[model samples]
Target: MNAPAPLEIIAMAFSLTTLRVDGSPTPALCVDDRYWALADIAPEVLQPEPSRGLMNVFGHWEHSEPLLVAAAERLASAPPLPAPHSLEDVLTPLQYPRKLVLTGANYYDHMRGDAGHSDWDKESKAPLFFLKPPTTTLVGPGRTVRYPEQTAKLDYEIELALVIGRKARHLTLADAMDHVAGYTVAVDLSARDWQRDPRHLVKFDLFGGKVFDDSCPLGPGIVPARYVDHDDLRLRFWLNGELKQDAHTRDMIWSIPEQLVAITEHLTLEPGDIVSTGTPAGVGLATGQWMCPGDLMEAEITGLGRLTVEITK
Candidate 1:
């Protein structure tokens, strides 16, 4: 008998989301508002790659990216695979990242206008970062962000989230892009009132404000980097249909490679770890508006996708 047939390899691009099918994580390819089960569309490709969920796909992105893309290219013309589901049925692209790193005030307008720090000089200063308790902070699109009772000052921030594709440590700014796999829209929800230490034992409590339930609403899906313009993508946010923060990646104080260099200097960044670049100006504290219960938040990064998360008590 013949041993087996080799799988055909080709690279295309599609946004990768996940669905809860029969109690297991199933990959779904998001084509606009519709989502098709990846297993149904490309069983041959899933055979070698992890079909479990989007998180696992990052581990094998080198081979998976192309294979999945080749399969996704036909989505527009292909017949229904059993049938596709609406965006409401799928989960965020990733949930359990090993680390959820966030940049603090990387956007120029955010720093000078919203954060009220005009003296920050990127040329002479290092980048700032904060880590969220991801397991609790992360929620999928269409999910609800529970407004914690601890703080009355809940806020919304829209940022470009980067999905790491390879293990990287001490990489130069020029080589940093090679390790990034994809991009997603992440809302860095915050509790402006709780962001400080009441006890005054420490400088601030970034977690106290940011670690509430559903603090980080990430993804409609992750679009592979090859499919997007990394340097000049637009980042927009909407609160209850009112556009709040509208800016571009060009406004960021530190470049993606700079952010990675800042992070990798402390520890190694592995595949599946998340790095949310930073939010633009127009946070509640800046605009004199705040997120309330029942408010809907939408975050969008150009060429990536939009993520909608409802706020609730």
Candidate 2:
């Protein structure tokens, strides 16, 4: 397979009408332009169901810069995009998403203990998958990650997330990349107690624990699929400014092509569908320490940019 070009980009922005702490409408731009308003755009430009307002912004950067300027002009003239209400207020332009699929233990070193090799051939016979509800998404940067009752050990997994560009079923590896619209940073927040439990064979509590309200903090921005060399990009996570998880995309046991091919065989992935490639090791659960109320979580991928969120009760 050839490397993807950088021009096929989709860009999304984190447009804020207010500062996160005071709730006062303070205009700012984190990814692109500060004045970008989702509500002012054509619905079709932001279409394809099951889409996250913010994720869609990040994934569809092709017209984003121009769109941002147009939104600012509209805001200056019309009733004005209302002051953001917890970031969700601007989501009117993004299509609502349904399911979020994530890969587990896809990293090379993560598979070394049992798989012996860095690729799937040396790893398990099949890809490991997990799901998170769309409602779990939290768009604002400073929003709190509530520590759910009964679960004392909470961890964070930093991942590169891809949004599906079109509906695809049984897509071949050769055509898999075509279905990708763009990429963004995702933090797969987990509750270690439920995640590591051996008694529950179905992992019901795992989803409940990890996919509860405000658990998934994504964004800051989305870089178009064209901006990254997916196979060789670098990803890293920092807790309180200290580097914790670091790895290259090349280390995945099951590459994106293989995973996309496998998933399309079982599920019809639609545009705006999110597939979070698994995180590298060094998560709190694996290291024996978990995140608490005051920790700051940050992640960055080369070309895709960076995202940081402060954990709060």
Candidate 3:
């Protein structure tokens, strides 16, 4: 497996309230694994709207190359993190994404599940996908996930989410990555009771079960595409202190290129749009176990950092 580059270009969004350099919240760039806060670096390109947050940095696709170039030059010196900001201060890196597209049964093992349908074609067909309400499901690391009262079975799905840097419509497989801004780790939280009903066999609300407020937890931060090898990263999930899901990106039935082509075929993907590649096997639904209040869930990807979410009643 080819590994990610040693120099992972990471960045995040912090609560302007929490990033007060001098008793007043300021828009600053947190980079290099949150160790350095490049205060107002390329503010014209990164922080056009001083009041808005990280999405500003991602929305300007035309400026991404230049911004990343400037960021890399600044990162060379390895400046110290500012006194006012802490990792705990980080917010969901990109808030209010225009859309959240997700692939379904994209992994062979995950598709197999317990029922083990052997005839399910793994190839020769386009991927099946679904959409989720964007900001309503989005939260960052260290955020608390309220267990919805509607369902008893809460599940977790760790997926590699792509951040679209440029507008794309009817894109070919070869041109897909050119539209990607970077990548981040995402937990596609689900309430399985809404997904399927084995007893009824007729009613399945996978759409409703898949999306709920605060159901998607993303971050630690976004890693620039240059520093990542998407096809071979290790992904793992932990429940409490025990490891639950472990897999590599290479196992994906449909590659990122293929998935992107499938999505862009119908939807015009825009900057700040997120497309989450599906999760692998080992979700709670397979084991008949569910997360409870006080449970801590951790999802980690090789180059991208770990994302943690706490369960609460």
Q: What is the lDDT of candidate 1?
A: 0.79
TM-score on alpha carbons, each prediction: 0.89, 0.73, 0.86
Sort every candidate by lDDT, greatest first: 1, 3, 2
lDDT of each: 0.79, 0.63, 0.74
Native RMSD of candidate 1 (Å): 6.3
Every candidate's CA RMSD:
6.3, 6.0, 3.9
Better of 1 and 2 by TM-score: 1
lDDT digits (tens) for residues 159-277 of candidate 2: 88887766779999789998786677778888878866667787445565567666676655555465557888788999998898888889887899899998888998876677889
Cα deviation of 286, candidate 2, in Å: 2.9
lDDT over C-alpha atoms for residue 184 of model 2: 71
Measured with C-alpha atoms, the lDDT of residue 308 in candidate 1 is 83
Where does candidate 2 have its weakest 10-residue lDDT segment? 12-21
Candidate 1 residues lying further than 4 Å off, grouped into runs, are 1-13, 22-24, 44-52, 76-78, 81-88
**Cα RMSD, model 2:** 6.0
Model 2 residue runs over 4 Å out of place are 1-35, 38-95, 113-124, 137-139, 201-205
| Best-matching candidate per lDDT | 1
Higher-ranked by lDDT: 2 or 3: 3
